[model samples]
Target: MTITYQINTPLTAKQAADIFISSGIKRPVEDLARIGRMLEHADILVTAWDGDQPVGLARAITDYAYCCYLSDLAVCREYQQQGIGKKLIATLQEHLGEESMLLLLAAPSAIDYYPQIGFEKLTSAFLIPRSK
Candidate 1:
């Protein structure tokens, strides 16, 4: 499959929700409005497309100079293990400044995957649980 990457591409909430569901990412896919808001507020968004199909996505909020929070990284289950996720991250990094650092909170199932793609495992991070 020939996959193309787009940065800051306009994506409808439904398209994003579909990818989230296909990739087994735990998101509120049923709440498209919330998803739309997430997209609206992200500072960077990279998407992988196989023709018209969105097979992968990476969304982040960054200061462009200091730090970045990579909130989501996902590739469709059928499209996994093919370096799409890695490419998406690489694309995201290209948009960030050299001084900026990228970080994310991986799901339990994805804890091992990030390290394989060059993310350092950090034990010093902390977060307040989100109430939804």
Candidate 2:
């Protein structure tokens, strides 16, 4: 499919929202302003594109040495199951180097998917659920 990957590419909120909606990924896609803010505040963005179409993406925040919190990973519905998400994570890792740890909170529906792609689930992690 000749998919291409990029780092820190300028992404519009509409494009990100479209991918989030189409990929069935849970996010605040209904609010463009929030989406724009999310993209703006992210530390890193690894995006996969087919020419001009954003097929998959990974958004992360990292200290660039100790840990990388992978906040978002999404692939278009038609683009899922093609290992694009894996490639996105791998690219993100390549950008981070081996000194950092990559971590993410998986969607309930995708609980099994991450392990198959080499993500080690942790039981000790805790979260203060969002009030919104």
Question: Estimated TM-score per prediction?
Answer: 0.98, 0.98
lDDT of 1 by residue, 18-80 (tens): 999999999999999999999999999999999998899999999999999999998999999
Alpha carbon deviation, residue 86, candidate 2 (Å): 0.2
Model 1 stretches with alpha carbons more than 4 Å out? none
| Global lDDT of each candidate | 0.95, 0.94
Point out the worst 10-residue segment of candidate 1 by lDDT.
Answer: 91-100
Q: Write the per-residue lDDT of candidate 2 for residues 1-132, one digit (tens) a residue.
A: 789999999899999999999999989998999999999999999999999999888999999999999999999999988889999999999999999999888889999999999999899888999987
Whole-model alpha-carbon lDDT for candidate 2: 0.94
Top candidate on lDDT is: 1
Candidate 1 is scored at a TM of 0.98
